[model samples]
Target: MMLYLAQTTGEPTGGLAGWAIDVIDALGGLGIALLTVLDSVLFGALPIDVLLPLIGYTASQGAINIGVAIVCAAAGVVVGSLVQYTLGARLGRDRARALLVKLPGIKPESVDRAEAWFARHSTKAVLFGRMLPVVRPLISIPAGVERMALPKFVVLTAIGSLIWNGMLLGSGYLLGENWHQVVDIMGYVPYALLGALAVGVPLFLRRRNRRRKNAATAIVETNTSG
Candidate 1:
C-alpha cells in the first residue's frame, strides 16, 4: 500500500497524484467532502493495514486536500459506525448471545465485560474506540446491542473519528514526501503490540493455572490433616 502510494505520487508516475489533485480541485468543496466521507467510512471500517498509509500518502501529496478530507472521512466513519450499531441493536442481546455461543474462542464472559464497560462508559468507550485499530469496529457492535442514545453516539463518534482521521492526514501532510515512510514505520506499532500480547497471554495463563493448582493442593492437604 505504501509503495503504491509512493509510486503513484513519485515524479515518474506523478501523473496519478496530479490526476487526483485535479479531480479534488474540480470537485471544489462538495466533491472533496464526498470523497473524504467515502474514504473515511469504508477504509476506517476495514483493517488499518492497507487504508491508513494510503490515506496518509494521498493526503500528504495534497491529492485529497486536508480540510475537505477530514470532514468527509469523519462523516464516513460516523455513518459506518451507526450502521454497525443499528444492526447490533436490532439483533438485541439474546441474538448476540446465541451467536457468541456458536463462535469458537469467544468467551461469553468477555462479551459481558464489554457490555458492562459500555453500560458504565458508553460515550467514552465509543469515542475512544474509534481511534483504536480493531476495537473501533467491535465497540460499535455492543453499543448497538445496548441501544445507546442516537444523538450522543453520533456526536461522540463524529468527534473522535474526525480527530483520529485528522491526525493521520495531518501527519502525512506535515511529513510531505516522506509521509509514506512515517506511516510505514508507525504501522509496525500495532503489529508489535499484537505480538507482545500473543507471547504474554500464554505466560499469563500458565501462571494463573499454577496458582489455581497450588490453592487446590493446599485445600486438600488441610482437609486430610484435619
Candidate 2:
C-alpha cells in the first residue's frame, strides 16, 4: 500500500521515508489530498504518518499550501468513508454468510453473534466500531446485510469516520514534518500495552498471594491463642 501511494504520487518505490517526501514534492496540495481520500475510502487504508510528512515537506518546498492540504485531506477522508459505507449497505449479510462458509474456522454462530451485537447496539456499534481496525470494516458488512435504515447508518458512519480521520489528519497538519514519528509511535502502542498487561498480571498475583499468606498466619495465631 505504501508503495502504491508512492507510485501514485510519482515517487520511486525505494525506501518509504524518502519516497513519502518525494511523493509530496511531486503531487502538491490537491494531488496529496486526492491520494489520501482514494486510499482511505476505496482501499480502506491510509499511510497517515507518511502522507503528513510529505505534506510538511511540500510546504517547506513551497510546492503546496498547508490550508489547501488540510482541506484536501479532509475531503478525501469523507469520500473514502462514503465508499466504505455504500459497500456495506450494498453487500448486506447474506453475501457475508456465503463467504464465511468458505473460510476456515469461521462459524455460523460467530456471524449470528455479530448480527446480534449490531441489533443490540446498532448506533453505538456503528459509530465506535469505525475506530477499531478490523472491526471498522466488518461493522459495515452487518449494517448493510441487515438492511439498516440508510439515513441512520450514514449519520453514524459519517460521525465516527469524521472523528477518527480528523484526529489523525489534524495531527498530521499540526505535527508537520515530524508527523511520521507519531505513526511510528502508534505502531508500537499495541505492543506496549500488551507488555504492560503481561508484567502487571504477575505482580498482581504475587500481591494477592502475600495477602492470603498473612491472613492464614493471623487465623493460626488467633486459634492457637484461644
Candidate 3:
C-alpha cells in the first residue's frame, strides 16, 4: 500500500493542502491515520471532510484502496477520541474543560454545548454526535466525564465514524477527479442553510399567526350567532 501511494504522484499543490498531500503520498495509510487523529482532536483545524475526499480521489486514481483508507480513518478517529475520553474520565468535567480551553482554537462555550448535547441525547449522543459539526470531537469528552461504558462508546463511535467517513470517501470515489467540486460546493452550504432559515422562519411565523387570527375570528362569529 505504501508503494502504491508513492507511485501515485501529482503536480505539487501549494500550501498546507499540498503539505498534506505530500505526507499522505509519502506515508500512505499511516499519514491518513495520523491526520485523522489530529482531525478528531483539533476541532476543525485539519478539515477531514476535504482530506477524506482527496483520499477517495487518490483511490479513484488507483493509488490506495478506498476500503483501507476508510478503515485507517476510522481507526484514527477511535484513537483520538479515546485520548479525549481518557482525559475526561481522569480529569473529570471541570478540569477537562479547563485543559481543553487552553488548547489552540478550542472555545469554552463549545465545550458547554457538547455537554448539553450529551445531557439531552445520553448514550446515543456518541452515535449521532459523530455526524454533527463542532460536536463531533467534543462529544467524547462528556461521555468520558460521565464514565459511559467503554464498549458502548467504542461501538457507537466506530459505527458513526464509518458512516460519515464512508459517505465522504464514496463521494470522492464517485466524483473522480472533480472531487474538489464537492469542497467548493460545501463552502456555500452554511450560507445556503442560513438563507433558507432567514426566509422560511418569517414565512412560517406569518402563516401561523394568520391561522390563529382566523381561528379567533371564527370563534367570535360563532359566539355572536349563538
Candidate 4:
C-alpha cells in the first residue's frame, strides 16, 4: 500500500525498501526476475522476502503480472541455487562446510541443522529450505555436498521457490497498500539482515581497525619497556 502511495501520492519513499519497490515498478517482471537471480547467488542481493512482496504489491497495482513475477522469480532462484549446489558438490563436505559456515550472516547452528535435516529428508530439505531465511542458502550447499540427484534438486527448488514467491507476492496483491505489514510480520530474516547491515557493518569495520590501533599501542609500550 505504502509502496505505490509513495510513488503517485506525495509520501516519502521508505528508504531501501522504497527504492526496491520503485525499481520493481519501473523495471516490471524482467527486472524483478533479475533481482531474484542476483539475490539467490552467493553475492550480496537484496532479499527474497523483501523483493517478492514488493513486486507482488506492485502487481496488485497492476504494474507487473503476478504470474510473470512468480515465474521469473522462481526461475532465478533455481538457477542461483543450482550454482551453489554445484559448488558444494565440487567442494565436498569438509571444505564446503568450512567456508560456507563462516560466511557473514550464516549461523553455524543453522548450517548444522540444515545438514542434519538433509540427512533425514533430502527432498524436503531442498523444498522447505527454499522458504527459510539463512537456511535457504545453506541447505542448497549441503544437498550439493551430499550429491543429491540434480533432477530432484531442480524439481524441489522450482516448486518450493514458486510457492515461496507466491505467498509473499499474494500477500502484497491481496493486502494492497497494507502489504508492508506482511513484510513486517513475516520478514524477520530480512529485518535482521537490515539491522546487521545498519549496525553490524560499522561495528565490524571498527573491530578490524581496532587491531591496527592496538598494535600501534603495543609498539609504543614495547619501546617504553625497553
* TM-scores, each model vs. reference: 0.58, 0.52, 0.74, 0.72
- How much does each candidate deviate from the true structure in C-alpha RMSD? 10.2, 10.7, 7.4, 16.1
Ranking by TM-score: 3, 4, 1, 2
Worst ten-residue run, lDDT, model 1? 41-50
Candidate 1 matches the true fold with a TM-score of 0.58
| Model 4: how far residue 192 lies from native, Å | 21
Question: For model 3, how does the per-residue alpha-carbon lDDT over 87-192 read when each residue is reduced to its tens digit?
Answer: 8999999899899899887899889989998997777678867766778879999999999999999999999889878878778878986776766655564466
Worst 10 residues of 3 by lDDT: 2-11
Deviation (Å) of 132 in candidate 4: 2.3
Worst 10 residues of 2 by lDDT: 40-49
lDDT score of residue 144 within candidate 4:
88
Which candidate has the highest TM-score of all?
3
lDDT of 4 by residue, 1-226 (tens): 4365556634346765566666666777766776677777763346557566666667777777889988988998888888888888999988987886678766778778778868966787788667667567677888889889999999999998888788888887888767767767666644554455568658877998999999999999999999
Judged by whole-model lDDT over C-alpha atoms, candidate 3 comes out at 0.80
What's the CA error at residue 105 for candidate 1, in Å?
12
Cα misplacement distance, residue 97 of candidate 1 (Å): 5.4
Per-residue lDDT of model 1, residues 106-210, tens digit only: 456655655665675577778765655545545676888978888988999899878777777677667766665655665565466546656875898799999
Task: Write one digit per residue (lDDT tens) for candidate 2, span 163-223.
Answer: 6555555555566555556566545644654466568758987999999999999999999
24: Cα error in model 1, Å: 10
* Highest lDDT against the true fold, candidate: 3
